[model samples]
Target: MTDSLKKINKQIRFLSVYAMVSSVLLLIALFLILKKDRITGNLTVEELTANRINIVEPNGLPRLVLSNVEKSPANLNHGKPFGIPGGNRGGLIFYDDEATECGGLVFSGRKDSSGKYFASGHFSFDQYNQNQVLYLQYLDDNGDRKTGLYVDDWHNSPPYPEFRRTYKETEKLPNGPERDAKLKQLLEPVNGDPAFAHRVFIGKDANKASLINLSDKKGKPRIQLIVDSTGEAKINFLDSAGKVVYSLPNKANH
Candidate 1:
């Protein structure tokens, strides 16, 4: 070949090499930018849309999750689902240091085919390894609405997951004496401590009564201070049997 032709071929090869090297460098730069965006922050966006988003700890444990109904997660115990899988409503779930579910906020509203409507919102916090100890909830079942804040006691012996497992197993049994007996046994107190008990309720009931109800450890209502819809107010003290043993403004006082 002539010298001029050889020089032309050399120029073409050099251009080809340069283009390939430039493409590789561009890719490396893009990858670094993406990694930095995820790990170190400083990236900004105007908007983002997604079905579910999970924010995790450095070790990959989930710290928080925001999700839609179809992609919602179930109750998590130490990072594993424990209760009815997929039973949890769409909402935000908060995890504790141990990766256990510590609290949550959930809400839902819908109308049935029969034209009945229902809505509910709940915010609750759980005791370590147990169920909710405090909560505020609102429920509307076909327009019968009740909103309340409640405090409760739960057993610490059986971890919540174990208790739920046994309860689910008991529910599988046929409706009979055996099933009833199992339910009673499972629900009864453990070594004199109640398995679960509602200790206080402060809210408006379906009857439109604003009230404060205090219960004993066994969950028996011991006292109630109420103001009915008509604005009539009274205080009632009850016996363990749940019968009101005393009331303010009795016949003698009135």
Candidate 2:
């Protein structure tokens, strides 16, 4: 072959190789940038769904997989991957010392069908017992769905960790961000109703009071009853030591 012809062929070959390598490198760089954006929530759900690829982060941690992945806090069940799906791993579920950590709250209050979410057991108390903390939780995230009275308050001290927690008040209460308005609406008695005409009263044996059927509001009947030939009235109370204090009979319950 002629020298001029050979030189021309060599130049063409080198250019072809360079173009192929550059194309592959550019594609790789684009893929990496797109993946990084997804992990930081920059990619919308719609974008991710169409992408079909899992959004993996540093350490190759898969934070989410389009619409096919879910994750939970570690110690979720004391298992690996913490409690998340998608293979995303956080070192561990952090355990805070100064804050109290207990399970979710649950209660069988009368307002709701199943129950309210109050503090889990492992109660807390102030030195004076005056500022007691009944483990309370947010069942609805708003604290308006449940009540402590209906769900027998289980007062038992547990370890207090260092995060924020809610508590229920049995007798002594705290001045937190004021009782939730909805809570008051649910708890207040229906006033001016002929059905609940009876008023609450206190006496030495106020339990023995004679009833005239919601006559005056001193202490009235708790619930309406037809009283069959064989039925008994029951009462429940607590004592000084934070135990069932006393239980009296419903004398006027006839």
My TM-score estimates for the predictions, one after another, are 0.89, 0.29
lDDT (Cα, tens digit) per residue for candidate 1, span 1-254: 69999999999999999999999999999999999987888757799889899989999998888988888888788888885676458899889988999888999999999999999999999999998999999999997989999999998868989988998999999999999888887888465446899999999999999999999999899999999999999899999999989998686676
Worst 10 residues of 1 by lDDT: 185-194
Instruction: Give the C-alpha miss distance for residue 109 in model 2, angstroms.
Output: 18
CA lDDT, every model vs. true structure: 0.90, 0.32
The C-alpha local distance difference test score for the whole of candidate 1 amounts to: 0.90
Q: Residue by residue across 158-189, what tens digits does model 2's lDDT show?
A: 21110102223321345443555323432332
Top model by lDDT, which number?
1
Model 2, residue 37: C-alpha shift (Å): 1.0
Clashing pairs counted in every model: 0, 23
How many residue-pair clashes does candidate 1 contain?
0
Question: Pairing residues by index, what is the TM-score of model 1?
Answer: 0.89
